[model samples]
Target: MGTFGCCWKIFGVALAAIFLFFHDLCASEKAPNYTFMQNATAAPPISYYDYIIVGGGTAGCPLAATLSQNASVLLLERGGSPYGNPNITNLSSFGAAISDLSPTSPSQRFISQDGVINARGRVLGGGTCLNAGFYTRAASDYVRNVGWDGKLVNESYEWAEKLVAFEPPMREWQTAVRDGLLEAGVLPNNGFTYDHLYGTKVGGTIFDKQGQRHTAADLLEYANPSGLTLFLHASVHKVLFRIKGKPRPVAHGVTFRDATGAKHKAYLKNGPKNEIIISAGALGSPQLLMLSGVGPADHLKAHNISLVLDQPLVGQGMSDNPMNAVFIPSPVPVEVSLIQVVGITHFGSYIESASGENFAGGSPTTRDYGMFSPKVGQLSNVPPKQRTPEAITKAVEDMKALDDAAFRGGFILEKIMGPISRGHLELQTRNPKDNPSVTFNYFKEAEDLQRCVQGIETIEKIIESKSFSKFRYDFMSLPMLLNMTASAPVNLLPRHSNVSMSLEQYCKDTVMTIWHYHGGCQVGMVVDRDYKVLGVDALRVIDGSTFNNSPGTNPQATVMMLGRYMGVKILGERLTSDVVSN
Candidate 1:
């Protein structure tokens, strides 16, 4: 048989099996009566509802669930059902989604913005449904530094743990990545991964035990709250809030336009008791705010968008991590299994089963958890290179000699990322269709540039460690990124907003941002400690955009935690205020 025919037969059998299994489940257990609809008419506005959350993604899902407890809530998502989307449902074949949508088209591969590669999802679950499923939490010091009440972080962290069922996979899947790093002495002992959580070399992958990803849609579906209404493919264009000399301008509703240019105003039925929350992704949320005239007055004027509130910090503190991928060729095929390797569990069961463990903290299984800082156990092959007393003293002396800004940068690294370069996120254009021009002014700070050099050096050492002695792996050497003649090897560094530098070329080469954008619209700049967009009433932002500082991690779980926390605060305050009035 031809290759095409053979593959087709295999695919057909797999599809049949999936359908049969789900059919059996449907027979025994009751699935929610959630029907996928498109371009549906607005539901009758009976009276003022509790909350109207826009952009259902990582944060929006849990927010909807939490708010739906007491009052009626509405969730608007721009995508549809993720049931059969080839990219979302299948776990083993997850990489298939990374490929271009068009089959047999090599030229139409997954391209990143400005060539900086990163994964972004468009389905109901948002990026979680399509991401690598690496579960991790944010560092604690980073959270405390945000200047919010300690209780806020504590409550959110606690609630976030329960809502997402964040846990690691089985230990079998961790592999020897950590061992290799340890053997190479790439990871030191002093690096703190999280608060009171020490870094360790535990090799495994944390994934949803169900062989599928649970997204916001899944959570909402499982909640199956009759009071909450979900509107898919409904793109919110603007948030309409009244601001004519009131104690706090109430957010009435939102104005959204469908793909067909048909605009509709979704308003609360009763008085001005309802509020609007914008949980759109970093780029989309800020753009929506700007379009609604809640951004910088100067920039809004340029876009011909009238200024509703002169919130200078609206889009000012934009930041993102410029990510770089180091593809390590495995010496042998990776073993695959579905035995609940880490602390994670089946999505539906996890949400339903709650215990004291759920309330304490979400990190139940750390077997395959993603490590933000290098753990010594995970670095089994690396040699011990503890900083000597003399070296520590000298390092402190060197730190004292640095300028305050440079010192602050270095201190942040010592506390959070150890040593890594910094970057900036820039607004590309006002045109929503055109992707925001993100210029990660990576390797911009001299201190940060030094950090990049050190970081590369550390990664290189880890790859060469004795832990990988058994496996003969191929090492991809980074090319010289500086000004070179045409005769040199093809440089893969163009896509990088920052580049690596030898000790000598540190002053010259510019590297790419690691695709880590945070701090734009930081707490003081964009909003207060509560995450409300400064100067705007009834509207708030709770996404990666509101980060006061980079979490120095993958950022998904952290974003999830923040969303849950902010939702609690918003809902709790509203509930209490309503009670007092009544």
Candidate 2:
């Protein structure tokens, strides 16, 4: 009997091994055929593509997938795939993912000319692979202003949501934030809606129930694999222009370097519709244009780049939302949280919070919860008209002071959704690998500073509300009040002795970017309503750089929606039932 049982077990094990081998083969067949370690030997010598999309980021991935439905599309990304990176896939490693500072990490961190630290995504999924995973549809006014078809935009939002968006499971810290926002008069309590509104609401997130991040690259699953070719680590240097003293320049192909540093050129096929799209992001799109001699003639000349088109607006009119935060340390443990709740105030400010314990694992007793700074722009080398010398000098001084402050506890991030001031980005050198000089010119306008002050006051009110009274504590013998009294009027300045100077001074010094850079290649100025570059044919700039204005919220969803919208337009297709009701 024992010998018979052993024989049966052996047979079962052999059968299981055979089944696993077949399963592996099937899985490999279904996986997208991405070119790994691309080199001269790997890529064909004169490859032809109907459409070549640069920068496989937040906007590029979806756009390429959508365009590949009928056309042969080539999507080139600067960084490798995001598939097995623990820092990118895990929610707890959110800070380290962006703050890694490694050259090969998915994120490329850089400091602005104004001395504020910021980072942008370099991976296949772009910023979507590295951001806080917050997702929300663009405001209706933004849709109308950008001349996007409202119905189509809505459909595109659904398309992206179905793939990566998810409703977060609320936890302790998020619940407290929602209640406090309501108590502070950001009312109506819209309750778990993705629509952008002027009240507290639980929006969508890209992280699913398992806390695993689903990036925009996942949407490539819907792509027709037979028609799409994705080349990872294929860094595009410039758009090859065919200019024979013609009135309008034509883009014939692109020059890119593979991971092995061997140069390759991929040209557009012989079709009138064949084109190259630059979705290299707010900073990248402008840099590429300038490198290809399509930006301001004077700026390009300074860098010794031969001018193709004197499109002055190519790298101009840059703007980014600035953030300011106030950290409140709590000795007690706070629940681990991301941006599960948001408070949109009437004063053009958005309030969100993140738990420190969620990022830095430690015992509950040592965890700190503090409100960080509001989002704001940085001053550039050539300061704009609005950036006064006083403001610039004060900003440098304040950044130094804020850096020295102790970091403890969970903090609220107050971001000004809209600002009147605008800055510009220009190339420091002609090298495509060199980071551009980005100048946000934050608080150039007094109104912008005033708006920031209003946001700071609003944050104070929420922190003072009874909803947060449970976490209140004292410093020395005095209560940590954030320097406000219940009887004080809204306009009254904070009386906190710990504050360095006036509220405006504090704002000028501590302001930082929420990394929401936009308007480098604005719609009306750089690209037409259809996103085609004005002075150049067979080229379009799609990405955050094309945004006419910031979307007043996290722009990941809007960027993806725009990609889908453009792809549908290029395909010359209307919203079918399958596309709309996703």
Which lDDT tens digits does candidate 1 get at residues 1-582? 232222221121121111111111101012235642234245332324567787777778777767777667777776555555443345323222332334211111121233332323444556555443444555566666765456776666555445344344422223333454445343333222223223332211124445444444555653436667777656677777777877755667887655455666677655334577788766667777777777778877877887787767665555444322122223343333221111111110000000011111112232111111011011211223654446434433433332221100000011113123333333455544334444344444455445444544443444455653333224323332121111111112322222343432522222223223555455667767777777766667777777755553445666766766766776678778888889
Stretches of model 2 off by over 4 angstroms after superposition: 1-41, 92-96, 361-408, 476-500, 573-582
Clashes of 2: 26
- What TM-score does candidate 2 get on C-alpha atoms? 0.82
Estimate the overall C-alpha local distance difference test score of candidate 2. 0.69
lDDT (C-alpha, whole model) for all candidates: 0.44, 0.69
Best by lDDT: 2
lDDT of 2 by residue, 1-582 (tens): 332222221121111111111111001112344532232336665689989999888899889989989889988888877776654445433333432446677767666766665667778788877666789887898888777899999999999999899999987667877898899888879999899998999989887787777777877876888788888877788899888886778998998887678888999998777889999999999999999889888888988999988988887888878776554544456765667788887778788876543333221232211111100121122234655657644543433343111222455667877667788899997767668998888788787788788877777776677886554444411122232211111111222334345677656655666778788898889998888999889999999998766784788999998888899998873234337646
